[model samples]
Target: MSEKKFQTVQLTLEQSVESRTKLIQGAINRAAHTAGVVSLAGKGVYVIDGLLMKSGVTLDVQAGVTLMGSGNEDKYHHRPGPFELLRNQTPICALIFGNQCDNCVISGKGTISGNYRCFIKANQEQAAHIESHHYPRPEMIYLQDSRNVTVEGLTIIDSPFWTIHLAGCQQVKLANLTINNEVRMPNTDGIDLDRCQYVVVQGCKISTGDDGICLKCTEETKRFGDCTDIEVTDCQIHSQSAAFKVGSSSFGNFLSVKVVRLLIVNSNRGLAFQLRDGGLARNFQFSDVKISTRDFSEEWWGNAEPIYITFVARDHETVIKPDDGIENVQFSNINANSPTGALIYSDVAGRIKNIRFVQTQLWITTEVGKMRHYDLRPSEKRQSLIMPVSGLVGRVKQNQQAGLSVMYRSNEDQPD
Candidate 1:
């Protein structure tokens, strides 16, 4: 990395206790420059780049202080310029709560901005095809591998990749964070937690080109563990792909994921849960979600399916036993407005149970044949919907009073 020349200046806040905000913020910038790291002793404003910590560090900003990223936008605001580069290094994560460090907190109304390629790249890869040369740009922020971390009331933007990526971490609480990557530049996923547990994503607004919130398990057989006890609530999400998705990478089991009270719009697929037969995915719920799609027809992309659930089979060469299947999944109070409407499909080889849609109002804004599935029917005309497992029984009978009641036989018996 080439070293950029910086004119340094310093002021000690403990001595100059009543220093003006301008003096304090300037001193922080100088101190961070001189030390080759961001180490401002007391509460103040700071803007410097390439902050590397030799040992673990804790950045505790007081309630009213702000930790801002150095950035200025191009004249059009369509592209971001260098004034936003937080760190000159490649693996540029804001708060690296390293493995051995616990009980770390990044709080206050601090604004962290950088041209995060990881943030921009993930979103870009989804919206359009990217070339081979753009692979090495910075992509992630706030990588946590520790326990008991809390991030609240922060504005993090212009990330090159996913805003916050947590891998194999536990007891994380993320609340009241405003993360916007709505420009649709490249690969900007809002939040992705790979193989993490006890994670809570609540009260956040995420707009991107890819999945707004993605919870992933193991990518392959080499990594073995489950992602469990994740809850997301009271959030607004928009994307080019599924607003919320789980498992294009379910090599590890994903259990106990719950989502509620979400408002999602302008997505190709509103909510998609995919299981890759690598491990078991069970006990999941997607409830009270309001979804709107611009177009649902495959005329744009033949592979896009809204509200999809599938279990991808194992590749023959790997000889990995099919360890994943979805069970006990529920979708309730889902209201959708789509041009081509939604599709509910599961692969022939997958196993699913208790897929219920309670009070689902699927509005086909245009009269089209493919959306016939969302229309209601009478009670006596209902039939047993059968796929692979023959005796599998579900009777969807709609009435003017009760709306829809889909009843199935108890799991104890499957007829010969």
Candidate 2:
């Protein structure tokens, strides 16, 4: 028997919010049944509550097409549910969401606008952003419990929260995507992979209010196995927080993480391993990264540390397995222009092991000279301490060790 042809449908959107939502939903639902493709074409802005992607479906947002959020809370009641990693509990919404789907792709050189300014509170001039405490702040894109997914070549902008969050997925590939949010929007991480496996992110440029590319193991999704075999490379990242961070939200062990050749444009912090939840990580490697960091505002999470590693429990009430720790992490050929240096600390001794740096150069600029405070945020009660600037600081036990090799510190006074 001959194979049935794949259905290919193209849509032009310029209608009421309700009409456009139904049109796109109908097109996707029909196309998904036939393993087909649905393209959102034309120059008009498409107002959507959400786009539900199913298995065997491809959403090709063509160039010049714009998918804009409706900015109405009631239109978004159709979302599957919250991912629950978000700190905000006001309302859970997403512009594009897929759950339990396989063989799906979202690509093209179009734009997805979150319309984030609508969610920001008015009449506030703080350097850091304060989101609306009472309104729904939806993510731009969220996919969970899916396999064989691919996203590429899209420009995602102005997100009120995390730009793209993939959770509990397998065999995902993200490439050549761009995320540029308002630099002060809170928690608008460019890409967050949670409890995911075999993911590759490459050739992307991200700038946001939080970590540019982050991996986490959330408390709600700890039932999944270790996050393993993830790679991020050839990306340019800038953020008010760390350019690349692994978990201030970790609740599961992470394994085989490789991040390389990232150009951090300007960040508040550069590289960090924040294991406040006691989840261990191993076999993580970072290399050939160039970073620029500066202290921006007190509302953010970091204080310009080029590399910060802390493996500490949140509080006395936090539970930690006896063997829960981070180890076998390495950073090589790192170059940074920042005010502060590396901070290696733990709540107790010997929790962080085998941390190493090779051929790292930190040019401590005099722009923000002599920062006298240390930050241990996302922790319990202990926010910061009055400390002096040093090239490197750490907490090491007598038996266990962390190593440093060929580190160069440069400033005006210290010529050598």
Candidate 3:
């Protein structure tokens, strides 16, 4: 790795405790033009109201420098009226935001604390008011329309919402990040890549209440382009939801994606591909993945399945115009132990085709408890087609049938 010298500035907030937020933001603003490093030194607690990073700046929190959020909702700024029709429809005011910036980095062996629990009462009350407007929760880091970004070696804790959100970004790299949010904190996804391309996430340890590492393409993101050419490898993930997922918001294509060498433990679901919206999710590859899934409450999205791939309308009532379905996916060297087996379901109009599972060992531990079988059901009154599964090591256990369950529903056929 080549090293580049950076003009550095050290910030001390102990002297002016009352103006700590202003001092930090001003330092970052000054560093943007100089391509400099703003180092938060010493063991002082620097409470930041919010930070909007400029291009070509590096916020380096040195060891023992703790940047804590003020935890005051009034201090944060929300994006005005019009909101994007994506997951987390509520526009959140974030702790650190990078908007359409380039060549930025947030790195160092320090802590960025969200202090999320301090607003539990407020979050609960806001949630209770269902008819009211969407509440503005604060994410730890929200980078939108940015390029050439790198976030490395940060210990992020107690995030209020999606911990690291990358929207409409390109050529981003996230490595060696240790993100630990409270298990009870809802919607605290570890790393969310929304309509991001040419991204690489590796050597990260993420444990959160929601999905660990997820790729989403919403309607707003689709306007930019498809999310393509992403890679995630060598990560330890534990989540109440799926450890690694493509989408619950797939409005655009997810192409040329790859995930390898993942250790997923104690997650609700191991791997999931949810293509509800009209999109094409294809040319995906997953290899050398070891997964352990357990049952969680229904309030969560998954059911402890080792692998799940489904295609359905976004809503049952609304009609979803099916585009190119999920196709040309490959999973190899996957060893999973779960209460439920793999589920690959596709509707009649959109079929999941050419799915190959090579050297995959999925052991359903029914002795632990009564578990559900692999469900391959299409929509109502639709003929279900059986796509071939090659090199499947484990059997689908349902109705005492042990081996493979590759059967098609024929309109003219009745069992003899």
Best by lDDT: 2
Q: Which residues of candidate 3, in runs, are more than 4 Å off?
A: 1-18, 81-89, 122-136, 316-319, 367-416
Off by over 4 Å in 1: 1-97, 116-132, 142-144, 220-224, 296-306, 313-323, 370-416
Locate the minimum summed-lDDT window of 10 residues in model 3. Answer: 390-399
Flag regions of model 2 displaced more than 4 Å.
Answer: 1-14, 77-91, 125-127, 366-371, 397-416
Query: Of models 1 and 3, which has the larger lDDT?
Result: 3
Clashing pairs in 3: none
For 1-416, candidate 3 gives per-residue lDDT tens digits of 22433544455765453387777777888787677778777776677787888888898888888888888756765554223454445556788888887999999999999887765654454341112123446878988889999999999998877899888999999999999987666778899999999999999999988889999986766556888999999999999888998877777889999999999988988988876665788899999999888876655677777788777666554245445578888888888776556776755443677777777776655433233433322233332333333212133212122322323222234122
Per-residue lDDT over 245-342 for candidate 1, one digit per residue giving the tens place of the 0 to 100 score: 77656667788989999988677667766544345778988889887665333222212334555554433321234444667777778776554433
**Positional deviation of residue 295's Cα in model 1 after best superposition, in angstroms:** 3.9
TM-score of 2: 0.91
RMSD of 2: 3.2
Cα displacement (angstroms), candidate 2, residue 277, comes to: 1.0
Between prediction 2 and prediction 3, which has the larger lDDT? 2
